[model samples]
Target chain A: MARSPFNADEAREAWRRYVSTGAVARRLLRRSTYHAWARCHDLGASPHLLKAEALSVSDTERLLAEQREFIAAATPFMAALSRAASSDRHAAMLGDGRGVVLDVVGDEASVRGPEAVPGPGCLLAEETAGANGIGSPLAEQGYVEFVGPEHFIGGFHPFTCQGVPIHDPQGRTVGVISTSVRRPAASQRLRDILVCAANGIEAELLRLRLERDVERVLASGSGSSLAKLRDDVVQTYAAARVRLEAAARRGPAASEYTLALVREAQRTIERFRHRAALWRDLASDELGMRQPFRLDQRVVEIVDLLATDAATRRVALVASMLEEARVVADARAASREIFGAIVSALENAGEGGSVEIAIRLARRERRAVVSVSASPAPGVAPAGPLAAQLAYEAAP
Target chain B: MTRERSGPGPSSGRDAERTALQRRVLLVDDDDDFRASVAEVLRDEGWEVTTAHDGEEALALARALDEFVLLVDYRMPGLNGGEVFEQMRGRSPSRLPAVLMTASKHVADLAAHHGFRHHVGKPFSLDDLLGTLELALRGGEPGE
Candidate 1:
């Protein structure tokens, strides 16, 4: 490894200037480091602090347990990184998003005395530990390094540190991986290693999550799978229906091929619809296993079933207004009324219109009110007969 | 496409402007066809809809845009809908108005647990989706 590019004397002078006068010396300090310094200063962190804060025993245990998967995914990479830097006298540290060091590996004495090595459970967040390897990268959610005097706290001044944030597949910075070495030992090689290790850990985390999701879906049994398939078939039918209806409204497409295609599409759609109806009957058997279910949940089922039906008519079906009351009614009857209301609304809903349904327990009347209303589509006339007819109400 | 005005009115113009502003929304779903189809319908309904295919894109958009109702799918490849909402809530000072869309049977409980005011089951109707968005925008919690 090569000596660090940063000048120790220069960094020391820059830190001195900023700490006393709050003025950053541009050419001497990195932009990220300057921002981190400003943040630490504003947070009232003591630059003279000698050691990082540690979490309580219980809190530390909880933090580790919560990060169990993350640790499992990252441990191998951490070990590899440690081995790669063993000759360079560097130690690797892992911290969660909050900058609590979760793990450390290799050559701890090379970076700091035993008391100052940010071992597991130490809080190295910028506000607490004052901008070192883990905290700086975690705070910026990016790559950063602190060489000697650039360290915000006096305790870390004898070390050079580099860190990179590790993100899950969702792009959330879940943790940071950092390395610390004796001053002048920092090199681009160490930064590259940190970056690669972080990427590896993230990829492993993604793989673990993918397996978990697959297991969850598989564990739910084949019924859920069939339900998913049925939903797709219904959505496809609805989309096809919408296109066919739109073409029909455009007047007879005089093209023979177009006419033939439309006919075949209609046949396919009819077959699919029939199959969907058969599936409904099959699903009813399972529904019987759990009778007297919540009406709202059953309504959700009907809405999902007929979702495409409403889309075929260019009508939006709004079921979010359904209340949370435990209305344990006959699922079949409730389904019929809700289905009838939605079907009626779809029939009368003009192009691009919406049908809003609300099922609320009429506390005073002790009857559940199933209200369905429709609003006109864009560029369409308002308050027409269909809109009026669409406002049908029923209490079942 | 050229759009025809039904009639001229200062009130109607104001209403249209207001609708466009108030109806800006972020639709996050991994399904390509479903996402595109819904976005088209919402646009036709006078909504300013922005679409993202996954949670990462959704979060980036949320960070960039100051305000918009989030219509996010419950089960995504990486971060689930609840996690996305949790991240947004953690990052911002105000509560972000959002609605959950899922095929799960436990949707109602999940939505309430995640602090979501409303939820629409998957393979949902356009009306249900729009209604849920409207409810979220209005700051009204369902089943209350």
Candidate 2:
């Protein structure tokens, strides 16, 4: 392969000058490249060489498991890029934002070379490997091409590399795609190829995320709509009943007859309102199941309300509380289930029994879980978990 | 020297009668029986009352009336109370004091959002309704 006219010695000279005089390497490098070089220096990385520190097999497996979705979405594009890299005797590497290479593909000779060869689980962060192709793009959050001696480490001077940062739907930098060639020259065409592949992967990630969201919505059904309709019906009936009673009181002569008729109509409307309210509550419960709520201050408020309720006055209620954390769940649904359990237990318990409820963060699961236990008076039967079943049956 | 009257006598009742006669209320509800009954009670109390069976009729009556307080039900058919009130506010040059009556516990929140002077929940006593109207007339807070 023909080498580019640009001399590698000039890049080395520029690096030496920048290191000794603390001057910017403007003519040979971009501003971002200089910033990356400074970051590497600040991180205490050696300018002459980098030690190979690959992640353990278990750590790599865990990372791959966590990023299964990303891998599934980017596989086809990565394969195509790998093919292109092989034709040029280069290597294509995909690394997470932390600069841990999750995948590497290319010709055996180029990928397995002794000097600065990256494999799966190899750490290429700027702090670890200095300002090279993967580390520079990861640091700058943009495309970067480093030729021969443009790399911060002298050991990497034999290879030319280009890299681009890949982003998720939210435009968060999630990973990097680095293409390295053993030849002295790195082409603009190579940089363009890596950028295109990154764009394709990002687009795929977005489509997959949207598909998952739509599926979730479809599974939850239209319970919220039904709940809203029931609310409207209940409101209308209540308004009508109020008006009928007022009319019955208007005239002294026909008051008895009018009152009797009003009473009949109100009885019918009241029955309908009661049924509609039940339906609304059920629908709301179902809707709550699909919704995610943070349990920070809301749990405290619910506990306070429960403590103030007339039903809890007869029993000793103890609540185990905790400082708030980022624990999210179907809080409304869960609360309804918990309330039902408590109500059942209290109703079944004999006079002078105590109930204990605990609301705390399950740190390992990263969620909030509520547990309730009731102790009945001597000779009284304990209430089972039948309340939750009843609640579920009642839900629309 | 002094005589106690059983009720407001002819001379003493004049001011009270005039105040009742001067007050006009536009009552809007969807149910025919409810509307008729409520309107009858308002008339018996000596106030001028106009009734509409639904939101559309309420808006039309509101537009034609020069001076009247609005007593609207929240969940009426067609435009519903809030929609009717919004349209009435938009079209009329003068702002009218409004009261929203509903069975929903969220009436207070609805009233706050829609700028109603008072909100009375349904199944309320006749005294409660009248008190709310009086409070609305005086531009006081929505008292229970």
Candidate 3:
């Protein structure tokens, strides 16, 4: 038979001294252990007998469900600890923050014996079970061990146990891992193992939390980038409409072409507004929307408007148009807002300045491209409407 | 439409003298296109327009001119519009009612902080700019 290091009389004297003068017993007992002793005393527990409150089956199931992820993460550690203590009459147990025993593994006959050993659903909080190993570590948020007479209850004098508090990544004490044996073993080595196991569980919790955060950031980043693009497009379209309206009021020489162009531009503006609204709506939807709009006709009309307006400004307009301009392909739909922005950019370059505007529309296999280039007249200060206009178009 | 002057009637001899005194405007913008177009409009409306390509030139003009309302761009290569306005306030003997124009979303905040009489955002209609200018000249009354 293995004997305890301290006898019942010594433990009783130590407890009495702690109760009388708290600081006098600090050498033999940690402050946390003394606090647990005080709590057990205040809870109306008897020091000479073992009595524990237990949670009902439904409550136990709810607690297990709430801690499902934690329990899963700590399973391998629990198994390894149980195997390490197999040679001794020891049982490994996991307890929640409230001290309810959630899991157990060991040689049943040896660990359980004739006494009703604490198992799943057993409430072992210090307030209910007195100053025992499992509940003390939970209360202290650190490692704890008690052998024989060190247990407050006389009935628990036959058993010895070691426990360590498990923490989450944020350093919050989440639960306790404990091992109980009928006879006391070398406690320091057992305490070291429990601490290492708790650390492994906390590391796993940190990794899981990091992965979840990364997933959320990636999901929100794509939507926000697209929203920014949509906002820029709407602003550019508004600027284009203002420029076109200003160009139309410039007088009678190019009235016919300007009138037709303005009407077409108005219709295109309306369509662009409608599409922008739709894009906003789709972005707000739970299921992501990836719809594209056809903009070939609008692109052609905008090009014509740019050409006519440039000619009226007397800035030398030059254009090369495609016969069947495939401005937007079925697979990749281009925005009318882009074309409007380009037209606005060209008109601003030609307005009130002797800047020559060049526009080109070319058709490739699956894409239609439009490019606008401008060259200001010499002796005109380089700081002109074109620079300001280009700056606005290029702004994110 | 012939808009009525807000302060005093142009027919009054005293009001005519005041109008002549405040007829000059200092237009400062880096962009030549905006300067030429806006100067043409202001001149057509019977105000003498003096132009400057940047802030330094505008400050030099302000020192030389007797009395003028200032129209300045907010963002410039050297000495931004707000800095120029501050420098002008320091140099000018009289309170200069001015209009600050910008293409930024912070125009209202900038205008309030700098105590500008009025502000207009870019891509603004010609009418809007004229209206804001008229209001600033009229001691900032609510425009009709």
TM-scores, one per candidate = 0.41, 0.39, 0.37
Distance (Å) between predicted and true CA of A122, model 1?
A: 1.1
Return the lDDT, model 2, position B48. Answer: 66
Candidate 3: where is the Cα deviation over 4 Å? A1-9, A12-33, A110-113, A217-396, B1-144
Ranking by DockQ: 2, 3, 1
Best by DockQ: 2
Per-residue C-alpha lDDT of model 1 across residues A1-396, encoded as one tens digit per residue: 122356777788887887787665756766677778878988888887888889998999999999998998788667656754666566789999989999888775654556446788999999988879999998888899888888898888878889999887678889999888775656544455566667656645654543344345457663443344354444444343332322222222233433443454355355444445434443343343224455566557667665644653557888897775555455545555566666666555666888877777766655556677777777777443443211112233
- Give the winner by TM-score: 1
Per-residue alpha-carbon lDDT of candidate 2 for residues A1-396, written as tens digits (9 for 90 to 100): 212345567677767886677554656554556567768878887775655467999998999899888776666556545654554677788888888888777777766766447787878898888887777898888888787777887777777888898887677889888888888876544454456567656645644553344345446874332323344444434444444444323333454554454454445454443434333333343644444444435444444434423131365556665335444345556555555566555555535676666555655555555556677777767655422221111111
lDDT of 1 at A118: 77
Q: Score the docking of each candidate (DockQ).
A: 0.02, 0.10, 0.03
Clashing pairs in 2: A247-B37
Better of 2 and 3 by TM-score: 2
- Model 2 / residue A201 / CA error / Å: 0.7
| Reference-based lDDT, residue B80, model 3 | 72
Docking quality class, candidate 3: incorrect
> Where does candidate 2 stray beyond 4 Å?
A1-7, A16-30, A113-116, A222-396, B1-144
- Model 3 chain A lowest lDDT segment of ten: A387-396
